[model samples]
Target chain A: MKNRKIRGAYTQYKDNQVTPEDSYWNRRDFIKNLGLSGLAAGSMSSSALMATIDRPVNSGFNTAEPLSTENVVTHYNNFYEFSTSKRKPAEMAVNFKPGNDWKVEISGEIEKPGNYTLEDILSWTRVEERIYRLRCVEAWSMVVPWQGFQLSQLINLVKPTSKAKFVAFETLESRSVFPGQKRGVLGFHVLPWPYREGLRMDEAMNPLAFLATGVYGKPLPGQNGAPLRLVVPWKYGFKSIKSIVKIRFVEQQPYNTWRKSGPREYGFYANVNPKVDHPRWSQATERRITDDSFFGTKRIDTKMFNGYGEQVASLYSGMDLARDF
Target chain B: MSYLVYAAIFRLLGADPQEEMLHQLGLWTLILLLSGLSLTPLNRIFSIPKLIQYRRMLGLYAFFYLVLHILVFFWFYLDANLAELFDEVIKRPYVTLGMLATLLMLPLVLTSTRAMQRKLGKRWKKLHQLVYLIAILGCIHFIWQSKSDLNEPLIYFIWLVSLFSIRAYFARKKAQ
Candidate 1:
């Protein structure tokens, strides 16, 4: 596995050389091995159990890592088609579209703002394989080997102005492309045309948040934010906008999709802080996506900032997370 | 599940202890939602005059899955940090909707018994109306829960909309 070098390009040029089912089985094995080991010999209290379980799985390639194309495509999602519940995304997102002709638009505070196609973007940035521990705001998680590059490179190339205080993202809007966009089922109020999200100037520029074009060293499947998507590792999963088409650098805080819908529930800075409690549920713990069977059973503790305090903690220096939360 | 747990202990020595729990919870949620939806139709169609009997069990099961959902979230992922749970429910609308949908169902579940329903009277229907609200909220809850994709919630909403519309149509027809 180490000897092989996966392609570093976008556009689903062709079906993955390795089959999707193969990846799924591999991921299942990876999940089985990692999920049962520590939990088996534990007499720890609930709190202690959570701390031990919550740590992200940092294993090597052959040591049961669920970074295959199938696992990347099927698992790790917030898409709730099967159930409104957490597990729905993975179950329902399986039948999504996968193809070429996908493109991402770049605009806003840039001097040269235009529609830079997916192919065009891939031509510039070389895809680097980086396995990131994704922690959602809902307290669920997954360790994904994401294949993309620093978002700063794209933003820098655009030459954003000094007035740029944040980088706003927009996902593709096609009633045909996305079945949910056509049907206003969740709420008639939410716009189906363009789903948007924004990140702080520094957070957007952080090397951790990649403008992911691919996953598992291959092109991203349509189900998993195909073409191009944003991956903000530290914050909740929603912060990372998927299937993006527009990038706007703004002086003011852009209206995020969730925050705009319900300001009280969603905040502008959705950093994954374990200190705040969701009015209806607790964000204190999470379930790693890789744990297929026990994925629902094993709950792990959350860190202050998804365990990236050393890197992104200063961003929220004096801000009251609970109040903002 | 108990049998599976027992068998796994001896056979699949390294079986995930939490696997059955997760499956049971998931299946329970599915059954709860389905059964909860059936109450109105069952009462009207079948001679389940006291259809309310099943409401609590169904609602409680839904709540049960929700609890499992939250437990799995906190235990396996967040490590039981009250603050982080607070942050997520407060900071994320999808999580909020998910949370609200479950929480709203609580009072309905709590007050679902025959005695409580008798005590509450007309207020019972009013309170239980929360089920419709919860179903809607649950749909929204699931819809937003999806970070980008919206297919699952869309399907659920289609079914829910049809169900509600049918109920509305029947009610209007009955009034006439």
Candidate 2:
């Protein structure tokens, strides 16, 4: 009788309210309150609940930070290509389908430089869940659980030539599909077309460099950079260029979009350095966008290398971050 | 506006509603200040003198939003840390400019009442000429603070410049 009662002691409480909290409360709550049709998984096992249907073998990286809610993650994105406004993208891109036959071109100093289909590319790399702290230069952050593989795996498969000094990634340029690109305010392009980003050869080869194809164990929505996007955990979120169409292994430091637009404020080495403040705002602290009332969430001090310094600080060596930043 | 506050409370303002609301409030303050400044020109341009009657009200409302904007900053961003807020205003150039512009508004708002306006007479116009400086400061404050998008600030600057030119032309004509 007690077992059937769900909450043995708290009889009035609902099963969800009484469910004994494991350390996986965020994931459990996430799955339980997805606010999507996936809720039909109520009958499924909690282990399988993570992926909904297919329980693939995913030995993924883990993080202790509570993941941001699906509602917040999906709805709120800085996808300026779709819309300059954060809230507008989800609605603006509701009909946007990246399509199955999307091809990614690998050019420049790569040995096997060719156009690979999305399915073909998927076959080459292993996809796994990686809960990463996505810090924005705007002094805000979100902990997102992404399903992706190490970018190094793709780099290895492509086999960059000795001359290759940098890797440049470009966003899909479809002005027709993306309104922001088509007509910025009063016909001014808000930013340069074919939005781009780059990383040094070492940065590209780092174990933390990822190519996310999914978020929250589901295929990414168009607003959140569908198809595939870079996920450089230690750098600012802008470094993670989205909806990539091209990957170029170049001999020179590639021209990144933000740096091209605002060089004084944004730089190529946009490593999440607390000491290096953006010209307009301080990076000393970041508001972690989690479950809170409008003004309730307290801003936490921005960490050196975004708390992933142990893994990546050696990559910077003795370089002056302030100068590069 | 209260709509921004309401939208933020209901989560209608999207993720990071506080940030969005802060921007919205600041933007509204600028718009109101600009609108208030344009009334005389608007009256002259259209030959409708009645438009000048609402300038004081617009200025007061602009002051209201500016107050709300600062309160939100203290409440949400600084967590009411006066020391931190002080550090920001002192250290950060854009923040410093904004703080200065807000502080200058104190005298304007205080001497805005009808009895005070009548008491000062011609001195009222001279004291209120401080608005031109205030407008310039406000424009630069917004312009310098804009991280990447210069278009918005540039437009504000153009508007401020045009307003200054019109006000100067009127002043020169009156002096003649």
Q: DockQ each candidate and list the results.
A: 0.14, 0.53
Model 1 residue-pair collision total: 47
Docking class of 2: medium
Q: Mark the regions of model 2 whose C-alpha exceeds 4 Å error after superposition.
A: A1-60, B168-176
Give all candidates' CA lDDT scores. Answer: 0.64, 0.80
Fnat for each predicted structure, in order: 0.17, 0.42
List TM-score per model, in order: 0.60, 0.86
Best by TM-score: 2
Q: List runs of model 1 lying over 4 Å from the truth.
A: A1-73, A80-100, A184-193, A295-297, B1-176
lDDT of 1 by residue, A158-224 (tens): 8988888998888776655565555444444234346789998888876677877666656676656
